[model samples]
Target: MDLSWLIPIVMTAGGVVALIALVAVLARNLKKVPPNKVLVFYGRKHTTEPRHDADGKVIEAGGTKGFQVVTGGSKWKWPILEDCQEMDMASFQMKPQLKKIPNKDGVLVNVDAVASCKIKSEQSSLSAAVERFLGKTTQEIHAMVLEILEGQLRAVIGTMTVEQLIQDRETLNTRVKAEAMSELEKLGVGIDILNIQSINDDQGYIEALGKKRTAEVVRDAAIGKAEAEAETKKRSTTAAKDADVLAANNQAMTFEADKDRDVKKATYDALIKAEQARAEQAGPMAKAEAEQKVVVQQVKVDEERERANIEVQKQKALVAAQAEEAKTVVPARKAAEALVATAEGAKKKLVIDAEGNRDAAVATAEGEQKKLVIESEGNRDAAINAATAEQKKRVLESEGARDAEINAATAQGQKLELEGKGKAASIRVIAEAEVYQAREVGKAQADAIEAKLLAEAKGILAKAEAYAKMDQRGALQLILEKLPSILEQLPAIVEAAAKPMSAIDKVVMIGSDPNAPAKFAGNVPVFLAQLFETTKNLGFDLSGALKKLGIDATAISGPDAPKVD
Candidate 1:
């Protein structure tokens, strides 16, 4: 209603237009060549004639209908009016397989090589590239340059040996570049690098040459070392002879010094023994003088000893008399001391006996009192234990009664549960049997109906075929026979309904008023109506036969009809 759907449509249109214009601008402006690349644009042919510079080189002052080469800067080329192609001014690498190139040694070698090339930035070289490799990519230009360099490498290898190619690689590079230089410049590309990466031969000639030269060098070195060793040995022999002469002269000087030292040692030993014998003679003369002085001193000592002996005899007689007097008095003194000791011992014995008697009496009384206390405590503990046992006995009896009650209840519950399970099992079995019997009877009835329908359809088909060919009478006969058989089952169906009346148990009277209509044999009329409705399911109209038989089908349908079981 607001026309809001137009907003996105208009915006998308504008955005798409802007995006297309940007893409077009990009496509045109993308033709701009950088400083490192040369762009050749010639679809419009801005140049027509070959022009020249001051050096008489064919310069391209692009104004006529011809190709023009641009080195840098943007060019506004209209769409579908001009086209531009680029040539790389930077180096490009190309590897080439150079096989079976002969060398100066007449050996065939396999060589792998690489080439680097770029477009020359000058007007003439740029013009040449526009004329030649203008639409060529970097790889295409490199492949062309590689082909030229590969030919040049083969020519250079022919002039040089394999050893020169391996050892002096820089010289090989110079020759290869010089050979390829002019040809590449004509194609408007310069050679920045030309390298021979490897060279090999199936015969291993290069390896054999290197080994031969190395062996020659090794032989020369061994010869030089052997000559130097001989010269060194000659100088060593002369030096050893001079060393022997000097050693003999030093030995003669050592022998002369040894003889002079022995003479001085012998003279010094003789002087020491003469001095020892003179000191031994002085010892005995000193000992004899000491003994003569001791004999004079002993005579003076004997005179003093005789005077001292007479004084000692007088003192000994006085001491002997004093000893006789003291010995007689000492016996009576010992006897008195013995009698004093005996009386004191008797007093101590009496004191110990009294203390022993008192301690024994106290211990007997305490023992009797402790025995009475222990007996009373034991009696008290026994009474308490007995009381606790009686209370425990009463509690156990009560718990036993409660447990008996709980067991009785549990047994009663289990019995009730088992009885309920038995009743439920019986009910489930009866219901299952009823359902099985109903299903089996229904299946048998369906099979009989289906067989009868099939036979009737076949008869109708046959009669229709017979009527279409033979007559109309044949078709009418099958209809008459099917009609009478169907009418015959209607009376039997009615009897099957009334047959359940004999099996009824009780029919209760349920009504608001006792004077109201009765419901005796109530289910029979509903069963008869259902049985009548069931006859309509067969492929026939039961009303023709029912009306001819004069049965009141309406009386079985209404609500006030008499009920029969």
Candidate 2:
């Protein structure tokens, strides 16, 4: 009776379990794809609709690795029988530090960079990324990106210089990204940011370069300052001389004007006096002649006496004029001599003082000044002689005693004027000499500074020109351009090296024979050492670079080539 009741309850529970199992199987077969991810279904033994061309011909193609990928959609798969894989479409970051990378100039540098990479958005890109990196962790993907970027960085750095790395960041970044573009595209990785965080050097080369440039700038500044100072000094000296000369000329003009007015006034006074004397003498002579005529018969002796008396008056006037002329001439001559002596004494003292204090060049300049002064004195003496001759000629041409007296006064005035003019000219000459001396002194310094600048400019310009040809891109261009020249010099280098080998008496293989593997391997380092030695004077290792490019340097050198066998 109990068994009959148990059968009904067990049958109801079994029916409920079967319903739940069917629902679970249906749910497990269905998959929902997210918007930013792809769902790949493979090994499901299913086929999509056949693709056709315009003619509707059936062209069935199998998916790669028997895999069908559906992106951003749902798919069906057997639960626990097929595998499901997922790849995140999110961005990833890769930070890497490239260390001690040698640049084009052989400078060691380091670059720390950060890059943001992601799977490309296209369906094909998703397929590629899923195939290559579907199971890889986020850290693993980042590591792969770093490895790719490091490889590209090494290649780019090999072609670039330290300056380009530091200063040409845009070009450097572009080159780095371009270098990894094809590889990343193949793997469906898109680089969003290839940012160079920092670039530095292990050596103090950059700092040293800055210091060198600074020193060069300082030297140029010092030179420019000295040149400017010299120019200013020259201008100042020239302006000073011009001012002094102008002042001397103005003073001479003033003196000459005063002398002219004084001479004119003295001549006018002398003429007035001469006219008065002529009037007074004319009346006396007429009276004497009339008396002589009247007493001609009675007193011929009286007439002679009258003539003698007129002659005596003429002689007395001449004697008085001679004494006055002598008085004026002697005093003027003595005063001129005193002034000349004083000027000579002043000149002598100045010259002696200058000689004691100044250099030999200054003394030489002073001597030139003295010569000019002496020549000027000779010119003044000639002028005086000419003035005296003019006075004598005027005296000889005189028609009367009054005219003679006027002529004498004019001559005396001319002598005074000549003396004053000579003194003023001497003073002007001395002042000009001093100005010239100072100018010469300034000019010497200017010449020295200019010469030094010119010499340094030439040397620096040559070096600058040589260095300017060494820009990273330009240097590569030059290497390509000068390849022929380098090839041409190869023969000469071989010849020189051969000369030393020819001088050597013997060569012996100590470690192993020529055909030995260890000997052959050992020769590579020896040959490299010899090559480096050969190129040491050239400032670069050409052979090493060529060998890295797969060039046979030893073969090129021929008989004189370093042994590598």
Candidate 3:
């Protein structure tokens, strides 16, 4: 009975221990990748990853071969088939120091730089990193990166001159990064940053360069100061002459204007006087014409009165002759009738007497009528002569007055013409004088400006010579270093250039395009292209710098970019 109980207890105890050991082994094999590390599981491998078609349908249940990698996750290793290892993904800082590296200028330079590198997180790069850096300490990783970078830095410095090394370290840094990245990629190492800390030469070349630059700058400053002073003196003298000439011109113009005003005033006064005299003459001439007309009418009335008197006298003479005829003829006829009735013999003598008396009366009446006709003819002739004489006198007086008026007008016109000629001659003389003064002043100013411009051109030529000596890449790198500040100021420059648009109160667009304003605003991007183009012209290719940073310059400067104008 005791033996049977012991066997069950022993078997139970053995089963529990085996279970605890299995749990311990399983826990140990289940590895979790650290946040800053990669866990690689190696041993039994597969040929390929899982494959898919266009529609994502599984074409093959592919498996990984050689080694499988995990970054920041947990994975259980096959107990007998696979083993797990952790690779440090943490970054390490490096200070690569190169001693007496010979540069392109044949000068030995020592360069010091700081850099940070880490194992790449990309699958291919991580696999490459896993092969070399597996189980490697952080110090070992730092040392490896330092060796790669220092070699690259040496090569980069050797390609540059002493002046470039001092003035353009950024170019050195960029080339080092570009060159080192190719070598480091083999070991799956990536450079986060590479900056040159210091550069110096054993031969004291940099100090000499600095001293030479300082002397050049001082010489340029002195020359600039002298040129500026000379220019200032020339400008002062020119300005004084210009001021004097302008004052003289102004005074001449004022005198001419005053003289013109006075001449015009006199001309106007003469015209007014002439018109007033004409007006005065017009009234008197009209009155004289009316008086002449009245005289003509009075002459007509006197002629009419004389004719009436002549007619009245003729009528009275006719009446008296008729009465006489009636008295003589009637009495004679009555006497003849009385004699014929008394006696035949006495009737003949009485008839003869009556006939004689009738004849005498008829003759007397004819004589009276003839005398009245002669008197009427004389009076009518006298009246006609008087009227003709008055008319002739009035016509002569009118002709004399007209001739006098014409002479006065001709005299006034000649006086005005002579005065105008004098004034014109005076104005011409003054204008000629002012023109001469202006030409002299302008010529002097031009001479001064030409001298100043020549001086400026000389200074610019000197600067251009200095800039021409710089390497294109080094200049570009310098520009790129300041590119951030330049970009920051671009908006301000563009806004300031467009400031005139703010002064416009209204814009009247006359085009078929509705996006005119948008296109106008889009010029800002085009201005960026123009700025880049201008930099390129100056041997600083900003586009090349942008391309190094993995930016597509073509995309930034598109084909449809608006023109700045």
Clash counts for all predictions: 7, 0, 2
The residue ranges of model 1 lying beyond 4 angstroms of the native Cα positions read 1-30, 45-65, 137-139, 227-565
Candidate 2, residues 203-318, lDDT tens digits: the string is 98867776887899999999999999999999999999999999999988887777567557534543443344334434644675476445443344444455465555556555
* Candidates 2 and 3, the one with greater lDDT: 3
Provide the TM-score for each candidate, comma-separated: 0.35, 0.35, 0.42
User: What's the true lDDT of residue 87 in model 1?
Assistant: 71
lDDT of candidate model 2 versus the reference: 0.65
| Candidate 3 segments exceeding 4 Å error | 1-35, 46-64, 78-81, 265-565
lDDT of 1 at 343: 41
Q: How far is candidate 3 from the true structure (C-alpha RMSD, Å)?
A: 47.1
| lDDT leader | 3
**What is the full ranking by lDDT, best candidate first?**
3, 2, 1
Superposed by TM-score, candidate 2 places the C-alpha of residue 193 at a distance from the truth, in angstroms, of 0.9
- Predicted candidate 1 versus true structure: per-residue lDDT over 11-35, tens digit per residue: 9999999999999887856667798
For model 3, what is the C-alpha lDDT against the true structure? 0.69
